[model samples]
Target: MLYVKIHELRKRKFKVAQIAKELKVSRPTVYKYLDMTFDEAKAYTEQPLGKKRKLDPYKDWILAWLEEYPHLSSAQIHDWLLERYPDLVVGGSTVRTYVKDIREVYQIEKKVMIRQYEAVPEQPMGKQLQVDWGETKQKTTDNKEIKLYFIAFVLAHSRQKYMEWQARPFTTRDAIRCHEHAFQFYGGRTEEIVYDQDHLIAVSENAGQLLLTTEFQHYVNEREFNVHLCRKADPESKGMIENVVKYIKGNFADSRVFSDIEDWNSRALQWLQRTGNHQVHQTTKKRPAEVFLLEKQHLQPVSSLLSYESTHNQSITRNVSKDNTIRYKSNRYSVPLGTYQTMSENLVWIEVKDEDQKTLVIRREAKGEVIAEHLVSSEKGKLIQNRHHTRDRSKGVEELKQRLVSCFEDQGQAAAYLDEISQRYPRYRRDQFAIIYKIIQQYPAFIDTVLTKCMAEKLYHANDFRDIAHHLHTLRDEPIEEGQPFYTSSPKHSHIKASTRSLLAYTSILGGRA
Candidate 1:
């Protein structure tokens, strides 16, 4: 009816609105159905005798072409067939499905079977978690080669998965830390965690008596989590997480470009909630997020004031250089001058992040006064002599002047040298000077002497401290009167006379008298 209206309107040169009114239909209806309603002139008439061509003759050639170019589409195959088999009577649409069927029959195409998975009857929510690592090649901004490992953890009952990347090489520490992070991420702990017999956490590969790394076992027991090793060569024991590993690699890692591991994980986690978690599980026919939300209620509550060492722990020992600087990474970090008076030796806990293996040392003060503390790395540098001070928005230079005064309060004459540095480098703020103060604290005994020497030599840059320290070492050990050195009477002379006057003097002074 719409086509008839359009045809009539076209014949009479009428507008579509007039045609729609005449046809008792909306203008859009008339326009939408116009093409379908309009009749097209036939190009040929039906004939009793028509030519028929069978494609069976070209079947061998088609099969050979398909074998050579397995990925070629049906239209491409049709064109190629038309070039040689002009008499072939196969439509492109039909040819495509035929080729697809042939590939399937030959097992050339990958087959995905959706098999039902039966949940273990004894397994309960918050009972078990599976852990695995996924790795892929990556390049950093500095063109450094790196392999990115995504640590994936999934709860058995909820199927709630957590994935994050490791910065450092995979080790026992990394595996244990991954579990700790996953527990904290989920906001609770699981009763048991399943694992593959990977060397990172697994100590030995005895089938029945699998031995987990001591460190890993300790972490689990401390957290009240049990360890369950999956059967070797059988991923089905922890099959849920194997599927998760594949999903994260394909859906998260493959679809994104990342400059850093954190950025990659952030995007992956965003997609995890936005896409993966919300989607219905293939076998369970239930959304994982919904199920996980329900399972979270069953999770064991974390105890208040739980005492545990950091998962990423490293030891820091106190050492004050003769020049009064705390040594770390062969570089010096400063503390207050009188800090040594409070304690002879101090143990510091350093949290080493696996992603970059970067260290963060915690500092605590007993009083309100600013004391010696280790400065954290802000950038890549061996020594940062200059202190870091935030810009004073209100008092401005006055605040800096006060900081300089504080440094002077700690070191009397050394204050003049710091004042000179502040005068020379306007950009050097109080915080930067505080770093110097920290250095002073670490090496209080020698800090004053070193500062005096540095100022006398007009050494301002922090990097110059290394050279000055080396020069000071030379001066301190300047070989007292060479040839007549302490060992001069050694060789057979000392054995010949045990009570010689020179030997007696040396023995009394050196406290080596027998």
Candidate 2:
């Protein structure tokens, strides 16, 4: 219409400036329309003015790189191009837009979509809770980027949700802890929980059957709750929790400042109580907290579920070392010596009852036999031993001490030495006594001498006793000349000859009288 008006005005001898002012268009637009025929102006309006892009020359390279590394971000691709072709200069946003277009054109496989399923109707109140994990990168107050992982649980009927965040990924133990807290927050637990095949809970799926992780399976059995695993890659199956994850990211996490994980979690709890659960849910149009009151009665009583103590019961398999010890939480706990007679053949299942106290109950995995129990040590690189596990070895040491004492008429000193050694090196008493026993066996005559030297030097170690024994043996074995007096006393030798002559004369006198 504007073009026709312009043509009619131009034929009427109207100035291009007047047409531009009347139409509120640029003078150049008016003049261009004035120059074109009516049909030509319409055709020109239909065609788009294609502008060339700076990245046009590198389209082929970008597309090829995307085809090879589809996961690379635009910034990463930009850096790669700059390195590959130093003369290339392109903005990151341009590469991002171009990469997106190339992906659409080539039909690149960005993500493999699983089979879709329709939404399932809501179950009875407290009948099911959908659980999932979501991760987001957050910047700390110090301007450091940290990844936060959240475990989200949403009631299927009430749409009530519970979430917890941590700076680290959730292990099986952490998952269980989060579940317990969620249940406690709701004042109860649902009869079943729906999961999206989380590796932390579900290990694998075969023929539509879910194989839960051992820890999760035990937890389910203990809590008396059923589990429903969603089909692989099927988020819609447990979409309630997925939405909760998104809602948290958009509403609570955006532009939030938290000092640390604990602070964030505390704030998150307050957010759930004050805003998240109290707000009218989009789908249900009812406050989740309000609906949860009705659902809470349907949920299993908090007291009926397993206690927090039972939920955290952890059974970890550990290889027993040759010294009858197993490492746990950076400390060593002793097991029975027979527990690992063959290398790599024995694995003990350490059931930790109290982590704070470092108390553990150990069992032989192969035979299901309870071998030993120990109070775990808090200090790292320290060994906590149970003397009962080495009772036989202790008995052998007792026998050696008795034999050494019997070798002396004055056994008081020897008994005192053994007692002192047992007290000084309580854990290694057997080893220390064994060294003493070796010294006694090698030089029975020098046993007292070695003990005296050990007491003088305060050497309670086994090697010290061995060294003293070697020195004593060397001294006792020194050669002596036949003419030299063994006692270095001439008066004692002359008295010894006179007594021998008197004894012979007395025997002759008695024979002659008979």
Candidate 3:
């Protein structure tokens, strides 16, 4: 404006001094502006509105980045400058201004990304409910940051939401509690509950086969609700609850001062009534709580609340001894052998199998698989055990080996050969010993010959020993005629005939003829 006004005043024949005083400027500034031509003045005005900045050296680089990634923010560009040029000396604000100026000069627009979502078919009322868990950090009233974990539930058709927060991470038991609370709030549950493959719910889902944790599996069975676990990394499958989780974290949890967990949960409930369930959803264009009114009639009535006190706490931890026995009220009850292999501390659960408390049951740590169930004995200091739990003493491998060696004429040689076979097949050494013992008993007469042949041929494998023994036994049992080959010989070559000659003539046909 000053440059154009200087020219305009001069064209009106105003003196340079008068123009300077009228424009409220110094004489040097007015003289500098008066020297510019109209074209030069227009070019000066066209230039980007900023003085030479400290980031002039990186103007081209910044312009290239903005062109390639239009979504890049000023703070991101500032970080890039520090990373690309470690010795860079500039403040964040300076880089921000320079990036802004470059963007405006080049007309490079920073575009916002909009995720495209297809319209999913509306789920049947009371047929589907999406469940998800999320955690966020919120500063409490005392200005201390606390991370709170929460689980969110949303009815698919109505989008009605229910959420609960906890100070610590939620376990399967806690998740069950949250589920009961949600059921009580909604007055019912959906026929099928959709969820991410959360650890609290499922342990793994491979090839569409979902393996629910034991406690969760039992709860699902008890509630009689069909479960549909979503594929990993597929939030769109259960997007309604996912969005509710985000809404709770952003609208309810963000900038909201946390107090005790009870207060936080109370606050969350109030928010659900105020804005969460009450607000008109952007997609449905109807309030969730209002729509749920009609959908609630379709829900299945809550069967029974599996209270925390009723289940999962009746079993007591007991240490499993090396002999696979657990000490109970007064006796040592036996479990199956190898039960101690999986327990880190040899700890297992001993629960009363029946409500009458007449049957005692021992189970695994988490799977609740019953290991043994026995009739409770009233007498003290008695060993209550199952006959099947005993390790068989008659079929011990060492006993078989010792008995087999006693049968052979050269017991020392037999013991040494068996040792070599055991070493060669250590993984199945016991199995090999049993199989060899069976074959030896089958052909007691061929034992000397078979053992001798095996020793000579180094046939230490049980299959090889069996083959040789069977061959010799076959000859003794079913003998062929004298001078007869066991297998028929190939047919003579009668088609290509040669004249018969004496055996001595063969030598004459050789070099002996020379």
RMSD of 2: 17.9
Model-by-model lDDT, in order? Answer: 0.61, 0.77, 0.82
Estimate, for each residue in 110-224, the C-alpha lDDT of model 1 and write its tens digit: 2344557676664588888888887876666676656677788887887788887855446565666666666677878777778898867777767567677665667656778
* TM-score of each candidate structure, all chains considered together: 0.39, 0.43, 0.42
Candidate 2: tens digits of C-alpha lDDT, residues 241-344: 88899999999998786578889999999999998899999888999999998998998876635554644545656778888898876788888767777634
Of 1 and 2, the candidate ranking higher by lDDT:
2
lDDT of 3 by residue, 1-514 (tens): 6577788999999998998677666576567668878776567545543366678777777888999999999999999988999999998888877776566445566789877888889998999988999999999888988888999999999999999999866767778878988998999989999988887799798887879987789889888899999888879877788888889988999898887999989988999999999999999999999999999999988766464464435565577888888877678899998888763657777777666668888888645788899988888698888989998753676788898888799998889888898889877778887777888889998786677777866788888778877887777867535344333567798698887987678878774752
- Runs of candidate 1 with Cα error greater than 4 angstroms are 1-122, 139-145, 205-207, 304-306, 314-514
Predicted candidate 3: what Cα RMSD to the true structure?
A: 23.7
Q: Which candidate achieves the best lDDT against the true structure?
A: 3
Model 2: lDDT of residue 436: 71
> Largest TM-score belongs to which candidate?
2
CA error at residue 426 for candidate 2, angstroms: 36
**Candidate 3 clash figure, as a count:** 0
